[model samples]
Target chain A: MTTTQLSPTPRTTVTRGRSRAVLDRDALLAVLAEGLVAHLGLATPGGHPLVLPSAYAVDPSGPDAGGTLYVHGSVAAGWVRGAADATVCVTVTLLDGLVAGRSAFHHSMNYRSAVVIGTARVVDEAAEKERALGLIVDHMIPGRSATLRAHTRKELAATAVIAVPLEEASLKIRGGGPVDEPDDVEAGVWGGHVPLRLVAGDPVPDADAVTSGGPVPPDVVARARAL
Target chain B: MTTTQLSPTPRTTVTRGRSRAVLDRDALLAVLAEGLVAHLGLATPGGHPLVLPSAYAVDPSGPDAGGTLYVHGSVAAGWVRGAADATVCVTVTLLDGLVAGRSAFHHSMNYRSAVVIGTARVVDEAAEKERALGLIVDHMIPGRSATLRAHTRKELAATAVIAVPLEEASLKIRGGGPVDEPDDVEAGVWGGHVPLRLVAGDPVPDADAVTSGGPVPPDVVARARAL
Candidate 1:
């Protein structure tokens, strides 16, 4: 049962920055979908914390409760092995702009971020794992998966796909210009924000593709233009 | 004594993607300096791992065994309080491009990332804390702190700054086009990369600044153009 409102568990609640906390589940989904990279945090066997970047995809109708977030890594990676069946935190952040204030204390960054805390389990089933891998590839480049062939048995075996539920998640957004003190704002010091975005350059085909004399695929062109 | 090469401890070593591991200390510093936000991973009091995004700055000649990386947070934040004098992992990633391979299994992202694992301590000294805060502000906008007034004592009290040494850090970089199987590349499939970069848009002055009829500062304009 998907809910419209985000039900933040006790640990997921935003206690300090209550003003920036967003309770809407759609906001959480938006932030996750817009972000390309996710930081996975989990404890190592020695009890030390480890954080690694991974490509991820979200499936609203996934098998996991509250939907599923798929994160893939090499099966040989120690962090991937350690994350199996363990509670982990996934954070995706999109920096919007740089907030310049009249006072050093007020300098900040405009951003949208989502945090999810849940137990992650490795997907051992072949069918589910293949579907998750395809989702991840499509997440990066929409409609490109249909153009590619199926993954071989060896390739599928070499990857470890972990799924985490999106039940305990929270979103935070801070936008607009700097919020300076009244005195600072009146002091005539310059205060504003520099907008930032992730942009993509033209696609460069590889030697083989160039030699093959094939034009860039429509999906690849569309993805670059969309960015 | 700053070493020229990164001295990765057993845990910091990149065993899975050994080909991408960069050992030069300068490369590690470059990656850290280029990134504005860092994902900090640490175990909560309840032993569950948590990852939070924080603004960070790198100091090459600071009062730490291997220089220092300063990360600031609100004093009221639970994550900040939990990170004090605790082991933590900080990861900063800059996505360079999307690697489009001929096969689904070969799709990947080209990125440069640095991971630092160390014990973080909250800055207590007034002078050091103030300097760290200035660095953090300047890291976002060059010469920004000079235009702003000093931080008030009350404001300082409300902020918590944590410093982690640059020791035990490792960097990974994946560049160029996708590496696909011979069969896939020979099948006339398009393969290449779409370069991605964080760009800055025009500066938008605040209402007060617009009303004051003051031009955007040179530093702000230059920063935007540089991006």
Candidate 2:
């Protein structure tokens, strides 16, 4: 699949010893799209924090400030319903591993994370809602949407899609080995990032899959093979 | 290595959730200990949410409240310094993948997550602070401290160790497969949980290591060999 189109948004953080405190809009959007899941935090019924896991897709084509990002859920759910009033925050992260520095102060890790925060608008229109549904389905199984049964009108009525323009989003990244104090360079201990990764394996097709005889779709195959 | 220890002081919100969520102190601590990383979230300047990545080690035995979870930072860092005043949340999640069902709504993912919300306190004491630092080192690498340079007093002071008591913590989990609508049972889509896993592979030792003419630690070696 093509990488999501991203807009150019400048970063505002200053550097502290090579800290990658800034990443432009496209990099942030791509990181969000590469993700299959996101941890969405919102307010609970009693004013407590409520976090839910959800699927999301990047709509790199919506808002004027920065392309909007989309996340959908049930309309009555507190998170989706409260989107307009409360800030909608969704975070996607990829963990690499432990960075053992020679000095205790220099320890760190390698990770990629994007935090998108903005006001959300419910997609009241029918066409965009259906399209959003398709995008979600495709997100899980790229070409599977074309092969699945169509969503019933009742099902459509129960879902809610919200668009958050990624105007205020920012990305921070850290990688490489531990940045140790100058004197501890020769501490004689193994100190560096132990690379962590999420690797996809060969697909295990379902017993009742319709076209099991054919090779996996290039997209699916490519994704798996990339691992 | 032993897992991070959980505090016995149970709070109301921490006790919420199903049986799976009601883990004993050790159980909660084990999940955090075995897991290599955490997704740390804090409120942004605008009152929106911002989550970044950080490596953390639980202090199983130093403090009265199950020893604070030791997270490091630059002394002048604003977040670590400000965490004590605001609600700081730490989330550790292990995703197990898409649990697909005939009905789209029945889809789910099996995951283990520990959500901890608490006021953080900066560890400023000289002796106790060193213990937190050791736990963090051992947490990352079982026998690491004795393997490297010890922390100097100045380094310890400059490095902030912020601990959040696990009292207000809670855990949520969703596991198992698709519970499809009866009508969708016969729908011809390959449906069931696509099991996901993080497999450890062979460990390639650092090119420059003073191994006493020995192989990797048996447990670490076995972990890698399993994959």
| Top DockQ hit | 1
Docking class of 2: acceptable
Model 2 regions more than 4 Å off? A1-18, A21-23, A43-52, A201-227, B1-26, B61-67, B200-227
Candidate 2 lDDT score at position B206: 42
lDDT of 2 at B93: 76
After superposition, candidate 1 runs with Cα above 4 Å error: A1-5, B1-5
The DockQ score of candidate 2 comes to: 0.28
Each candidate: RMSD: 2.9, 5.5
Give per-residue lDDT, candidate 2, residue B199.
60
Q: Write the per-residue lDDT of candidate 2 for residues A87-190, one digit (tens) a residue.
A: 66677777655566666566665677676766677887888777777777666656555655677888888888887777766566766566665455544455
- CA shift of B99, model 1, Å: 0.3
Q: Cα deviation in Å at residue A27, candidate 2? A: 2.3
Expressed as tens digits, the lDDT of each residue in B2-70 for candidate 2 is: 112234233224322234444467667766887666766666454555454566788766474655676
